[model samples]
Every structure is written in structure tokens, then in C-alpha cells.
Target: MSLSAITLLGAAGEAPTLTVVGEGVVLVPADVVYVSITATVQDENLTVASSESSEALNRTIEALIEAGVDEGAFTAGRGRSVSTIQTASRVCNNSTCVVVSDGAVNLVREEVTIRFDAREEALINRSFEVARSEGAEAGIAGYALVDRRAAIAEAREKAIQNAEAEAGALASAAGLKLGERLEIFERSSPLIREPSYAFDPLGMRMTDLFDLSWPVAVDPFETASSAEPGMMEVISQVFVTYRVSP
Candidate 1:
């Protein structure tokens, strides 16, 4: 369509063929949370320790399952055993002897992961209790909401709108009429985290160590890893190209 036609459509409230990029954002509230409970068992006898740890892990998993937790949300991994080795050398008088030495490391750990929806706060609370009852410690691992596809689309539209306005203003200032949209390039808001929150939870109390407060900040653009949704800024950007009519 011609630039004049584009202008006319804009004036008449009709969809213009001009490459108009719009952006919109919607505040989406999260309604669900993911809770992860980890248990570690250590004993002197590797066999007895491993067996007991396995049983504890299983009981924890079964408890979660019995509470209507989704099977996909639960995981029971094999317990790991670790041993220490040492080497020593001694020399006396004119005779020297090399002795290979090793020490026994008696330790075993079992881990279980459970994921459940927080549709009900009471249910979440109950889950925590159940975990404790099963001799496992649990806490609010993370929070998530329903699919944000629609919200993202809305944000994309708003971005397109902003681009279109800029393009129109540019064309008007350049004394050239606006033309049809030649091309539109868009990318989804990248799911970004913060840089500071990266740590391995190897036999550590993850919940006690990290904070899970409100105002979850996520750049959605910066590609980083944050422990708790680093700073809560969800943003999207878009690029648009339009033709110019003489």
C-alpha cells in the first residue's frame, strides 16, 4: 500500500500495511511454587549406611506420592559412597621401604527431589510437614506461575507499537511518507537470571543459605544465573523495518 493510503488508514482507525510494531506488557501473578527436599545420611558402615539412607529416601518419596504429588515431580537417586586413600613412605637407617597406605572413608548420602504445584497454600504447608515426618527437610525451592505465552505476546505487540511510532515519526521528519512494513524481527524475552546466585547444593542446606523474598527480579534479557529471580525486571525488545514512499 502507498504511504498516503497508510496514513489514511491510520486516520480512519483501519489496520495499516505499514510495518507497525507494537508492544504490550501484562503483570502476571505467580500462583505456584516448587519445593525441593534433600536428605543426606552418613554412617560408619558403608553397607548399613547406604541401606538406611536408601530407605529414608524412599519413604520421603512415597510420602510425597501418597499426598497426591505428581510422579514426574519426584526423583530417587542411588546413594553415593566415598572413601579416602592415603600413601606413606618411611626410611630407617640404611634401609628404605615404601609402604602403600589407604584409609577407610565411611560415608553415604541419598538425595530425593519432589516437585508439586502450590495451588493451595495449605497443601504446600502440608507437604513440608510430610517431608519432616519422613525424616527429610524441605522448603520452598522456587516459585512459578502459569504459562506466560499470552503475556509475552502482548509485550511483543507493545514493542511493535513503539517501533511503528518511531518509524512514523522518522518518516514525517524526513519528509517521506510511510510505506508498508518491509520486515519485522522479534525475539522472545530471554529468560535471564542474576550473576550472583550460582552455587552447587552439594550436601548443603539450600533453603537456609538462600533468600526467597518477594519482588522477584529477572532481567528476561540479561543472560545470567541468579539464585532467586535476580531483581524482577521482565522486559522485551523488538526491531522493525519499514519502506519509504516518495
Candidate 2:
């Protein structure tokens, strides 16, 4: 059919609120992966601990970059903090004043973060393995895909198409031809859920009490293949006003 001919049949004088629901669905492969990891250090002396922590974190960051992570993925902490070891004081009921004994505190923990964007799913899987093996000591916080706008849009169209199909079916069953829609509206946002991260306790742990240093490794495996794909769904509704033949 000619474009003009089709448009002429569906033209509206004012704002046309055709209550005809249409649904459509489209599936697109996940295009990005994100990794979150933290580097931590600990020691008996705050100064010494801070220094060692900084050094270790620097090494970890260097390792990630050397392993192909970009500089943009590396993020370090603001400052060093002296974490105090505190014990609750006890008061004794006596005629004399009780001696207050506050114990000395000695300990420091330094932390840094590392992240990367994965364009290739397999590459992402490989990066996970590299992070754990080389620099990840405390292990990865988790991983995820960002910006799902495109997937949602696809699902929304599918949902609208589904609604339209239902409306047409009902009209056909009643021996009536579907007519102009008076109003159409989206019911809700499309749902898109995807699995982002998985953990293997055996692959991650903590060590080096003085430095609070540890090594982390991620298995190079096809996460997408191993895991089930998340669902994307859409929903919409439309109202139509048709003139029935007497």
C-alpha cells in the first residue's frame, strides 16, 4: 500500500485518542558488562598500614591496567583512617571513685576500587578471570550491565502488539470489524531482568594480616551461556469506538 493512502485512512483532525492497544517485542543481546572490585589493607600501625595499603592498592591498579583495564576504571580512596579498637567501659558501685581505663588503639585499613566496562561478553568473562588472578584480593563486589533503555523500548512495542491482537480477536469473535481506536495508553514500563554477577568462594579470600592484602581470581567462563537469559515484557491497552451495522 502507498504511504499516503495508509496515512489518509488514519489521519486525525484534532488529537486522536484511539483506544487501540498494540504490542511488539524485540530481543537484543547484552552489549556491556561492568566490574566492581575493592582493594583493602590492614596493619597494627596506622602510618605503616596506610603506606603499605597504598602501595598494595597501587600495585593492584597497575595490574588491572596492565591486564587491559583502562585508567578510567581505577578509583582510589580519599584518605587514610585510624580505625580504633574500643571496649565498653564498666562502672563499679563503691564508696571510692572507680578508675577509668581506656585502652590504646592501633590499627588501620586502606581501601581502593577498580572497575571496567566490557563490550564483548566473552572478553568480560575473561576479564573477570584476569581480575581475580592478578589483582583481586578481597574479591569483586559484583558485576552488571548498564543502560537498559533499548531493551525496554523493544519490549514495550511487543506488549502493545499483544494488546492490539487481543482487541482484534475480541472484535472478530463478536462478528464485528475493529474500528478506529478512541484512546490508547501504555500501562507500565517494560520489564527487563538480566543476571549480572556470580561468585565462587573458592576463588576469593583475604590474607596478609599486617597489610590486609589478598588475591582474587575470576573464572574465565561464558556467564551468559551458563546462566539463563532474563525476560523482557511489555504491556499496553487501547479503547476503540466502532459503528456496528444494524
TM agreement with the true structure for every prediction: 0.54, 0.48
Model 1, 1-246: lDDT tens digits are 001112222345444434443443344444556677756566556787677877887788788779867777664554354553344556455666656444454556565555555456676787789889988778766555555666566666766677778778867876878778767665445232222344433322333234222112312222323335412223345557676665
Summarize candidate 2's per-residue lDDT along 1-246 as a digit string, tens digits.
Answer: 000000112345443222344445444444443445434455446677677666765666677667676677656553445666654465678665565666645555444545545454554556557656644444344443356676666556555556556656655665656655544445444333343335444432222122221111132232332343432222222223332221
By summed lDDT, the worst window of 10 consecutive residues in model 2 runs over 1-10
What is candidate 1's TM-score against the reference?
A: 0.54
lDDT of each: 0.55, 0.46
Mark the 10 consecutive residues where model 1 has the least summed lDDT: 1-10
lDDT, residue 216, candidate 1 = 23
Q: RMSD in angstroms, candidate 1?
A: 10.5
What shift in Å separates residue 210 of candidate 1 from its native position after superposition?
A: 25
CA displacement after TM-score superposition, residue 172 of candidate 2 (Å):
7.2
